[model samples]
Target chain A: MGINTFNIEEQGFLTTKLSEFIRWAQRNSLWPMPLGISCCAIEMMAFAAPKYDVARFGSEFLRFSPRQSDLLIVAGTVTYKMARVVRKIYDQMPDPKWVIAMGVCTSTGGMYRSYAVVQGIDQFLPVDVYVSGCPPRPENLINGLLKIQELIKKGVPPKRDPIFI
Target chain B: MEEKIDKIVESLGRRNIEAEIRQDPLGTEMILNVGPQHPATHGVLRLVLKLDGEYIVDAVPELGYLHRGKEKIAENMTFLEFLPHTDRMDYLAPLSNNTAYMLAVEKLFGIEAPKRAQYIRVILNELSRISSHLVWLGTFAMDVGALTVFMWCFREREKILSIFDIVTGVRFTTSYARIGGVAQDITDEGIHAIKEFIDNFPKELEQCEKLLNKNRIFIERTDGIGMITKEQAIDIGLSGPNLRASGVPRDLRKDEPYLVYNELDFDIPVYEEGDCLARYYVRLDEMKESVKIVRQCIEKLPSGPVKADEPKATLPKKEKVYTKMEELIHDFILTNFGGTPPVGEVYHAVENPKGELGFYIVSDGTGYPWRLKVRSPSFTNIQELKVRGKGNRRDDMVGRRGSIDTVMGEADK
Candidate 1:
């Protein structure tokens, strides 16, 4: 069923706020395509593994395919060469998708302020939650995921003029 | 490289393969991009596979997706300031990276770390090796469809990380080693924790071996796959377990014997077969050897200062810096300018978890190095992919996963 095709009047008045219900459901099942590029990717995997368990927040099934996922976790240092590939993957994902910049490197280039590294991935893709650490702790990554869920639940307006071609 | 690709094409031609579709109308030669995003390539490594039906005609590995110009960054920062950057190189094995860089600088300065500090470095480096091998085992098994082994391996790895947290203060990016010695001394509790892990890890390894070692599917998938001769492995400059798997036994620890390794008694594991199974076995045996080394280190653990008293080479303690005037000046000089080694060059190599992780530093009597070149094992090991990928089927790429263990952090550095 299409997300927009749901009818409120045909269903009932008991479930009056259908949009809230849709938003609630949408926030819970955020499938992330972990764009694991460097050191931060290891911590992201730790978050998915038994200890941190990102699945507890309903974001554990790491979709390598961009089409199947809505949450994009860019988890490492993004280089200038990789920026093109990142943008291409971002464009490939369907509308109503969120991006989480999962480390200091992806958020602000961290320690690597070089010609090769892209300053920040937000310049290339719209970032929802920016987890700041050299490579953030799995707990911090989980907290960032929670913040993204909160934004989804509150129904923030979709970004316009986000991402480089 | 173009000549090698053409040679591979020629070899394919001799096996009734046509170079162009125009020459043979029914030819099925196709170029497939395996990833910069795909899961099986491990971390962002893109392989362009030239295929004819199911067989791989030739494969080209495309890197620099994760290149952060670590060496270039090294030229900008001081030798001490750059220690943290090495932690990101082989992110799985930070201790080994730290020791390798530290040894190179120590050599340049014509100084040696104290016996206690050397033993501590050995313990930490070997622990790092075990943790790295744990990750390799988990990911390699996961790639081969052994799902249960991945979870099992991580379960064991978490215990090691906790042990690291006690001594190093951080789990993943542990910038623990300094120019002269480690950041802090290992406590009695830390020693006990290491002993505890050493005692417990072997039993866990036994369980893992039961799950994987004799498994028919594992043997069938990996036994004869990705075969490399001793000459090919040596010519391609493979080191660590990958070289040892081909029966070379060219471990830097045994050959060069740095960081009190000559004092420690441990055997280097070697295998006659240079297949995927042999590589896997070599790592498993190495982990046991690492445990042996750690146990010996703890037994001969010296009680003394971890950091050297050299005012020029190392940072002074916070108490000394705050209280004493001479200490204050030393601290200022150390932090602002860093250590100034002699006007010379030195190359220090260590048997890292991956392979031979070496640092070549050119010091121009400055705090910052004139040039720092890293001879990363993953960078050299990935070349074997070109040699092994030839004549193998497209699907057999998974079997020839010696290069998949290469971290882009180290490989592209």
Candidate 2:
């Protein structure tokens, strides 16, 4: 620390920053769509409640249209028959959108594994974050948001892939 | 050609279905069938939307896609065996279904569950409520196009599921609630986990609100869309948060306190808007109340045997049932064929996270129940879509569903 301080005094303190710009953008604006499918969505609502005020993250904008959103979070199971539509929605999302595979079902097809279920949606669309659990705690989702922020900040929009419509 | 078009138009007009002069004037409006497999509709719901351009002029919701004939299936099973299937009705809020059906059976048995079990059921049911609402908010956002909230909502939901897993050894589809009471007692670690979750869950919700609650786009899309007025919602038999959103204060839990609800302090959050936003708002606030209920249950949780002392009706404890001969025989009989109930019928309801989930069971003094019918919330809740979604846009279906929060597993069955 002393050496760094001395070096900062000497060399004006060079810093290694990862995803700084994208992080700033994410911190200022994080839009999430309510992708509730089953029971997990209730906890999702609690995450946005006053006590759990999701607004503290400055990312409370849950866009209703794919064009306006930068994030695609699949909070519940993505059954086989629904995969085509999920893929289509992912396809419809404009560029610079992030996909969060929420819940064990969306991340890994959960226990609803019949002949149906696409497992993880990452096979169809690029998933930036995978929140584990039948449904994860809201804090885990917050952590996920931060991690995605880091990814977004480090991510160059052009380099990071969005489904090219 | 014009005369033929006029004749076709004349015939179409008689059907009371709107036809417009889009590019395909001779052809009817574009038909897009949504669901049977959709993320936003909550289950395998199929909506036939007749659209003029992108505007939805007519919508028809098709149910029974996920129908496993639950009512018929229920008739084949014994009273005790039917508990697990109840859990599947509102899969998102299985605890509520489990509790409601158990309460009905308890009514038939003419026995009150121990205080501890009541509190546990309340705690679990509320937790289920929290989970269900989380899902509704997350996917409603996705259906309307916001995606990040889905992840945000699920993150906190994991804690509740972990709690359920801890208490019952099952997560989403839990059949933990038994005939007389819950199968097991909650551990200290489970309580601690719940405390930790309850303590920390709010901040995460705050983070989510930062992302959504007040975005202009979200407001515009949801503000006045999919309106279900108080009268309309009541006429349609909506329950749970959906009914509360329509400015009606109807909740089976609150109006008719059963189990541990009499001891807990909570209120039904209501909104007069009755639009998507009001529904969303009511559910959002209810989550806070749920956390409060869980905290209360945690604070007031009693120490006692989890199950009731009904030898003929209740399953023996694992320790005795597995080790002792008499207990073993009892267990074997219970497993092989559940006990018979006297000829009687009971209909029980609970405020499942989705809505009011009720089970009507008729016993015939045999090992199997004569009839079992589920008055599923999702089934009734889904009917609102047809009304709430009339004259809406194509992409707006997700928003309408986001408001109602239907589950096909329960609805179709």
Two-chain DockQ for model 1:
0.73
For DockQ, the strongest prediction is: 1
Second chain alone, TM-score for each candidate: 0.94, 0.91
The local lDDT score (0 to 100) that residue B341 gets in candidate 2 is 64
Query: Could you give candidate 2's per-residue lDDT for residues B1-413 as a string of tens digits?
Result: 56755654453343444334334655656666666544455555777676778788767787544444557656666777777666656777788888888888877766778889888888888888888888778778877778788777777777788888788887666888887888888888888888998899888888878878778888888998888888998999988888998899988777877787877889889889888888888988989998899999999888897888887677899999868998888778777677656788888787788877777778777667778778888788878877766677777677887678877767765
lDDT of 1 by residue, B270-375 (tens): 9999888989999999999999999999999888888877888888899989999999998899888886788988888888988898899988998999999999
- Chain A superposition TM-score, candidate 1: 0.87
lDDT of 2: 0.74
Assess candidate 1 and give its lDDT: 0.85
> Taking the true A–B contacts (Cα pairs closer than 8 Å), what share appears in each candidate?
0.75, 0.08
The 10-residue segment of model 2 chain B with minimum total lDDT is B13-22
Query: Candidate 2 chain A — worst ten consecutive residues by lDDT sum?
Result: A1-10
Each candidate structure's TM-score, on Cα atoms with residue i matched to residue i, is 0.93, 0.70
Which regions of candidate 2 deviate over 4 angstroms? A1-165, B1-25, B323-325
